[model samples]
Target: MSPMETGLIGIGALFVLMVLRTPVAFAMLITGYFGMLVLEGSRAAGAVMLTESYSTVSNYNLIVVPMFILLGNIASAAGFSRGLYDAAFAWVGRFRGGLASSSVLGCAIFSAVSGSSVATAITIGKVALPEMKRLGYQDALSTGSIAAGGTLGFLIPPSTGFVLYAILTEQSIGRLFMAGILPGLLLMAAFIGTIALIATINPEAGPRGARVPLGQKFRVLVQSAPLIGIISISIGGIYAGVFTPVEASAIGAGLVLLLAFAMRQLSWNGFCRAILETVRTSAMLYMVVIGANVLNPFLAVTHIPETLGNAMVGLGLGPYGTLAIIILAYVVLGMFLDGLSMLVVTIPIIYPVILQMGFDPIWFGVVAVIVIEMGMITPPVGLNVFVVKGVAQDVPMTTVFKGVMPFLLAMIVSLLLIIIFPQIATLLPDLMFS
Candidate 1:
């Protein structure tokens, strides 16, 4: 059979396995190994699988995964999330719809520590949802803001999404981390603006809360200073050339753990729990990366990506037009696949096309993450929406989904602005690294 024919069949088998509820990592592994066997026999396939799996996990750069995950788990266990929310609320909870805005602000701040979107949503949602509800804020606005804000986790520094993208595309993780800073903040602002618009249209949706006194606000900020310091060290340290991504992760994790110990907020059991959770999450990510590595070789042997890229180039559509189609595909796939799955499944195929079009890899990393963030709040499989629903159990799924819609729009606008200017995502990395 032609390589194209074999590649198409392999892809079909992959989707079938996914539909059967097999884990995406295992599905990719099975499809890739079996395809390699068919194309190059058992000996070659076995060697490829073993080599890819070993080399992938053994890579020094990937240590950042566990370190950063540990940092987030430790921070969550130590109750820094509550401090972040309190500080944001003290500063923003007084304006009309300020409670919702505070939720967004808190999520953005917490995202600096926690890289997982669900973690950000759950952390901020636990702290902010009850307060918003107490203030008579509409369920949609309250839930929507948290869900949308949680997505900042995917776009901000310390992002696992960017890590995966960097590894897969062979780009510099530090540059991608820097690139995300501006766009992440821009999207956060868009979400805050979105809440204000919702409040303006219907004042009852978001009533103002009691204003915080200047002294109390300063006190809350002081309480949250450790978190602020951690963010500055981890993200700021990287930008300032003081730490590589790996060093930054290690430093961040150690500091958060020490802070937890100093505050006596985390018991020994809680410390062990954080370590165990970090191991579990890191192992899962490693397995997925191994699967992607194995599958990438198989796809290369099939010449699938080249064929796809050449086919795309032949269509005569300019780069932007082709980009639109790719983004649209992500939108459709987001309805079914989680963000990481979408990245592992598509990046090998799409990234070659992107590079061929003369786009900067670092910039595309930001663009791709923003699109995935949109997916986290989109319908049918909006992971963050469901996460917020889990927190706000009394809020209907429909209301949560409705609330997320405006934030989703804000994300789209943010995406467009980044596209039109490009520098919003690239300038920081260029200035810092170049």
Candidate 2:
């Protein structure tokens, strides 16, 4: 049998396993393992896959994963998320849709520190849900805002999804991070704008409240200065070359602990819990990465990606048409796979095709993430929406999905802007890294 036919069966088998509720990591591992045996013989496949797994897991660049996850967990334990929500609410709460707007703003900041969408959704949802409900915001708007905004973590700096994208495409991490900055900011702005528009069309959707006194607002801002400082250190330092992503994460983690102590929020038990959670999350992520390492090579050896890339480019489909198809595919696969898993599984195939189409890898990383972010908000299996709904039980799953619809449109618009003007994604990377 030809390698192509063999590869198709392997993919089919993996999909079947996934549908049957197998863990994504194990499904990929088992299918890839068996695929290799079928195509390359058992002994040869075993030696290659095992050795590759060891080297992949031990890489130094990848150490950033655990530390970044740890930083986010520590920030949560330190009560920093509340500080973010408070800061956002103080200034925005008087406006129509205040809670929903504040949730988006809070999430934008949270994204700077956390790389995972679920972490952002859970953290921000916990802080914002009750307030939104209390303020009489629509259930859909509150839940949707949190669910949609949580995706900012996927594109903002220190994003694990982007990191996985860089690793898969063999691009520079700094460039990928830099390229993502503007696109992520654009998405945030679009989301906020979308909320404002919705509120405007129906005043009841977002009734303006009495503004907080100026003095009180200033005090609230002062309280969140620590979070701002940490964000600046982590994000600003990355762009300015003041620190590598790894060092910035370490600094952020230390600052979270320090701020916790300063605010009298850090307890010994709380600290341990944060550490343990971080370890568990990090271990799970690494396992997925290790599994992908084994799985990706099997796909490569089959020449499937090479064939697909060549055929698509040869078809004379415009770049936009091809990109559209890719986006649709992500929307479907994203409902089933987590963002990191999606990156690992698809980037190996799609990213090469993207580069072959004459696009910058960094810019494509931002675009790809936005598409995956949409998936995170899409129904039936939308992870962020589920996380937010899990925390905000007052809002039904349907309402959450409805609320997120506008933001999903906003994200697509942001993606288009980035797609049309690659420099929006690439300029910062060029300025800093060049």
Candidate 3:
């Protein structure tokens, strides 16, 4: 059989494994190993697997994964996430739909350290949902805001999605992080606007919160200052060329650990749990990287990416037309696949096409992340939806999904803005680096 045919079959098997509830990392590993064994000898397959596994784990940049994860885990354990929510609530809770809007702001703040959608959702949802419910906010608005806001974890600076995308495409992590800044803030603003419109249309859906006293607001902001400072020093330092991402991550983690101990909020048990969770999460990400590395070689042998790129060029769709098609494909895949899995699997194929069409890779990374963020709140496999539902146990899954629809529209609008004016994603990186 031809190599392309073998590649097609391997892709089918990969999907079947995922459908059968196999973990994405292992599924990719299994498909790649067997496909390589078929195309080459057992010796070649074994060597590829061993080398790729070693190389992925040993890569220096990957250390940021565990450090950032640890920073977030430690922050959550130490109640810093709660402080952030309180601060956001104090500042914004007086506006119409203020509680819900505060939840979005809270998620965006925590996202700076967490670099995770599920983590951001769970952290902010735990703090914001109960308050919104008690204040008579509708379940749909409160829950939807959290779910949609959680997606910012994927778009903001220090994002895990950008980290993996950078590694996969050999783009600069700093540049990708910088590129994400404006787009992330834009999406956050769009989410806030959506909440305002909802409250304006149906006042009862999101009641105005009681105004916080200025002193109380300042107090809560003070409580949140440690995290805010750390995020600024780490992410901002990278932009200023004062530290690389790796150094920034290490410094951030170290600072968080010290702050936790200083506040006496991190019990020994909590500390241990944070470490264990960090290891588990980091190991999973590393394995996914390894799987992608292994699978890439097998796919190269099949020339699948080359063939797909050729086919795309044959369509005679100019750059924007082809971009629309690619974005549509990501949206469809996002419905079924976890965002990270979608990135690792499709980027090798789609990225070359993007470059060939003269789109900037850094800009495309921001665009790609926003599309994946949309999927995080999309139904069926909406991971963030499930997370918010888990926190607001009484809320139905359908309610959470329903809640995110407006915010989903907000996401689509954000995507369109970025596409129409690529500068939204590229300006920061260009100014900082150039």
TM-score of each: 0.99, 0.97, 0.99
* lDDT (C-alpha, whole model) for all candidates: 0.92, 0.84, 0.93
lDDT of 1: 0.92
Candidate with the larger lDDT of 2 and 3: 3
lDDT of 1 by residue, 1-434 (tens): 98778888999999899889899999999999999999999999999899999999898889888998898889989999999889988998898899999889998988888888988999889988998888899999999999999999998988999999999999999999999999999998999999898899999999998989999999999999987898899989999999999999999999998888998999999899999999989999999999999899889999989998999999999899889999999999999989999999999999999999899989999999999999999999999999999999999999999989988888889999999999998899999978
Residues 1-434 of candidate 3: C-alpha lDDT, one tens digit per residue = 99999999999999999999998899999999999999997999999999999989999998899999999999999999889988988988899999999999999989999999999999999999999999999999999999999999998978999999998998999999899999989999999999999999999999998888999989989988988999999999999999999999999999999999998999999999999999999999999999899898899999998888888889999889899999999999999999999999999889989998999999999999999999999979999999998999999898899999999999998899999999998999999999
Candidate 2 Cα outliers beyond 4 Å, as residue runs:
none
**Model 2 alpha-carbon miss at residue 285, Å:** 0.9
| Candidate 2 to native Cα RMSD, angstroms | 1.4
Top candidate on lDDT is 3
- Supply the global lDDT for candidate 3: 0.93
Q: Over 4 Å off in model 3, which ranges?
A: none
